[model samples]
Target: MTLKSVFVLTTLSLAAGCHGHDHGKSEGGKEGDHGHPHGAAAAELPGQSVTIWAQRTELFMEYSPLIVGQETGFAAHLTELPSFKAVTAGMASVTLKYVDGTTIVATADAPSNPGIFRPKLLPQKVGACELLVDVKSPQVTETFSAGPCQVFASADAARKALGEEAEAPGRITYLKEQQWKTDFSLAVAEQRDLQNGVRASGEIRPVAGKEARMTAPVAGRVELASPAPLLGTFVKQGTVLASIAPRPSAASDSATLAADVAARQAEAAAARAELGRAERLVAAQAAPSKLVDEARARLQVAEAHLDGASGRLAQYNANSSGGAAGRRFQLRSPVAGTLVAIHAVTGENIEEGALLFEVIGLERVWLVAQVFEPDLPRVQGARAAWFTIEGYEQPFVVDEKTSKLVTIGHVINPRTRTAPVIFELDNKEGRLRIGNFTKVSIATGAPKSALAIPEAALVEDAGKAVAFVMVEGEAFERRPLRLGVRSNGWVEVLEGVERGERVVTKGAYEIRLASASGAVPAHGHVH
Candidate 1:
């Protein structure tokens, strides 16, 4: 016989053996006794199965042998219908009621395997019976019923009925333990204020007046401050960054200027002495008062000359103390910021006014979003925005409360036909860097509430957007989704999923692969 025929015949025989017992009392028959062996019911019985679907909780229940005087095992799997993700923890109970007024109740707690519950129930008499299942989860309590079913005298009768029923296909069963082993995660689909907006490309730039260029003040050789500053180095305003000293050819001029300063100092000292002497003579009547006044005038004139010479010398000493050859001008940071560029290296000869270093404060930055000419009108109406930059997992938000719209360009670029719309963002954490390419969404319309999920939950299947939902605790169903506005890290779900459903937010592709490859394991009791 073929394998399929052999399997069927074997199952049928086992079913017949289980139910061939008499309906009368056994040798040890007591008040609840029936002919069938009680011990036999505890063992696995072939060809006897019944499955019940709980619509409220989306729980799927399957049991072996709807036969009296036998121990039946009911396996219940709980899932969230909307997302088709498994329900991991819940309390379950199964009550069997027979027409003869005999009732049996069995209870099972959540298993480590997740979403799978096994309850053992034993029926005492063969008659009409009803099965009632109650499941309690953290979110809700649900009850379900199956069968005003006939509790047959034997397993054979139960198997015969089961053979006529059809089984569900493509039902993937993943246990809780298995999920914990894999990179599985879930999130609730929730109602949120979704803003429909225009998407535009942009870049991060330092806010105006927040950046400064350090340039060489005079033609000289560069000497970097200790721990030479490089790109990305933080600096404070007034901190010396480098010193410049005049070249060899200009050393003589520096010396002459120094000599001139000394000459002025000597002359001012002599005049002050002469004025003191003249004032004493006038008091003693040895000199006229006019002579004393003339001495004082000479002192003032000499002091002015000294001041001018000192002023000239001070210019060269602006940065650092003078050396033997010339004064070394110390270049200090004009603003507190990070050094983003170094145009001149230490010991290199640079001409006056040459670019030296670029410092940019990162505490705040501007997002210069490029709005196409057609979308320029919408940009003016934008009240808020969220932007994502390359290499960042989270988006930065700008709203009227914390950010300001700096400007909207009146001129459009000839090549791209796009205008720059500027918004400033607080980057106190320094997570954002200048010149990073960005994608921005400017909210221009009124906010509306809708169901939404993380953008990561979405995947494309056969050219249609789909998401895996936990229908039963261990079973995930592939669902097609109709998507709407996308903003930040979330996408609006117009259809395919309901609020409260748990969808796979991580490792969905693995589940899809497992389903496609028929690698999903059978659901059973976990030790």
Candidate 2:
């Protein structure tokens, strides 16, 4: 969250990623010099070490106090933020601004080792200097301004100004090199709302008003549209789905239908004109508003008759021919969606009002949960929910943004002694199926605000819930947690970690393996 001046930039709650390559050779051509993982700079840096967070990157830097005319080595651990991965390739420059306008700058072409960029500065001016770091990677160009920095005249002056400090106890060294090499991530333990949850068996279903069923309009044989719709074919509303040719009958003549449509059109136009005239007269105060309302009603009735007449004529205009046979009726989808089901096949004879096609929108879906009658009282004030499906390790969350509670059904099943609680969820990713069975965790009860970390951050050690709290860039502390109620991917921390502390979330397993290996810090990186 914060840091101070010097030849470094880093984030407080930082986890590192492994470098793509580390050849283990220092910049000075020495076997274990400044560039090597076992370099002299690896020893506990004597001056200020801070972690700073910028918009696009996190910098964890350590430097032995900067002395005039002396090569000052800075262990600049640069991690790309949000993803919390090490910066593999980039140019990192450290600038020290003096009281005068001039400055001292050091540059590193790439990571001294991946995630660690060593930029050495030889100061010419011995006074307090403002520190700034500029980094240019393939993905980002970011700068960080750390607070005030100090430059001493000599080693004695540096030693006297900042004395010795003790290292933290029980430090577990998990180097930045190891972090970059694995699937690692870091997150801050912050206050979150934790609630008691109720578990229920649920089924995914189509949302209301997003599905439609197209049926036969008359007794006829079916004729599918060109490039006929198959199951799962996406179709838009009012699109021609299929047509039904009625059996030969005197009343089903196409010419008669056309004549009826023309008559209906003329009647509709006359009614529309009457309504316009009535409205204008009412505005002029020459006619009562009741007459205007009656004319409007007559127009609506006429329009409805016209629609029916037009539909009959449209059937003949469609692909159906009524030579010696009756007219054909067209069946079109009323809503936009996928062709989920088709009950009739092309050229198949079917009766009027028989089911033909079923279309249902699936962009969003509903999870209908059956809550036990006894638990109804507890779930009345539900706050959030999560559901687990097959093949998914992480459960999908159901919150106000992504989902809504449609209803807690009033009617209870007499046999099952349960009520249906429906939750509508966005399914733009097509993850949920119409008939998927899922186990849902419905958060209920009053919310409790407490410090919490991701459930993935925890490691079961000696039968205790433990997590690796990031102590610094290259160090971590295995803290045993006293956990409270767990819900929706976060575990409440009753103890053992503080607010704003970063913990490893993704690679905790590998970090635990590193701890068990008992490898020296040199085995990992030059920390």
Instruction: Spell out the clash pairs found in candidate 2.
Output: 9-59, 9-60, 10-52, 10-59, 10-60, 17-179, 17-180, 18-179, 18-180, 18-181
State the TM-score for model 2: 0.67
Q: Pairing residues by index, what is the TM-score of model 1?
A: 0.59
Q: Considering summed lDDT, which 10 consecutive residues are worst modelled in model 2?
A: 11-20
lDDT of 2: 0.76
What is each predicted model's overall lDDT from 0 to 1? 0.71, 0.76
Model 1: residues >4 Å from true position, as ranges?
1-170, 173-178, 227-233, 250-317, 341-356, 522-527
lDDT of 1 by residue, 432-507 (tens): 8888898988888888888999887999999999999865445677889999989777899989998877788776
Give the top-scoring candidate (lDDT): 2
TM-score against truth, every candidate: 0.59, 0.67
Over 380-455, each residue of candidate 2 has an lDDT whose tens digit, in order, gives: 8565798888777588899998888999989999999989999989998888889899988799877889899988
C-alpha-based local distance difference test score of model 1: 0.71
Error of 1 at 32 (Å): 34
After best superposition, candidate 2 residue 308: deviation in angstroms? 22
